[model samples]
Target: MEEGICYLTLNRPQRLNAMDPSLLEGLLEGLQGAAAEGARVVAIEGVGRAFSAGADLVEFYRA
Candidate 1:
């Protein structure tokens, strides 16, 4: 958390960090962490060209 606020980031770049089942768990964790710590606010960001592609084509192909 930053400034007593929660900051969560998507770590997938190759696929624009698309949200899969795993992402939900991590996001839930972040919110839970912030809530547990009594955070004043929550923020989300991306570390790639786009916020998210919504889904991962690479993984789909791979699977």
Candidate 2:
């Protein structure tokens, strides 16, 4: 990884690290950081079996 590279790992393993608003914000922050740092790469990883389930429907269902 580049020194300027940014990464955000979704720590939700049982739930497949589904994307939430917080995760979105984190991603945005990472993107901004990478851009600000003039990074050539930004990577996102999940601790679970999937990179992401796209979004968490259960969380959305509450809203």
Candidate 3:
């Protein structure tokens, strides 16, 4: 958090920042934290070639 701006980064570059349960949970937690901290802006970013692969197909298939 910097100057009321919250930065949420997806760190699963190995998996192209896939949207899995854990990632989703972390994002939700970050949002809540940002709100609690009175953040005026929330920025979501991914650390990889793709912002997101949409979803984890392998995990989805296993479920």
lDDT of 2 by residue, 2-41 (tens): 6867776778788788877777787788778778888777
After the best TM-score superposition of candidate 2, give how far the Cα of residue 43 lies from its true spot, in angstroms.
2.1
lDDT tens per residue, model 3, 4-63: 999999999999999888898899999999999999999999998988988988877886
> What are the lDDT figures for the candidates, one per model?
0.81, 0.78, 0.93
Instruction: Give the per-residue lDDT of model 1 (tens digit) for 1-63.
Output: 768888889887777879776776788998998999999998888888978778665566775
Displacement of the residue 9 alpha carbon in candidate 1, Å: 0.7
Give the residue spans of candidate 3 off by over 4 A.
Answer: none
How good is model 2 by TM-score?
A: 0.76
Error of 3 at 38 (Å): 0.7
Question: Which 10-residue window in model 1 sums to the lowest lDDT?
Answer: 54-63
Candidates in descending TM-score order: 3, 1, 2
Question: What's the ranking of the predictions by lDDT, best on top?
Answer: 3, 1, 2
TM-score, one value per model: 0.77, 0.76, 0.89
Q: What shift in Å separates residue 4 of candidate 2 from its native position after superposition?
A: 5.0
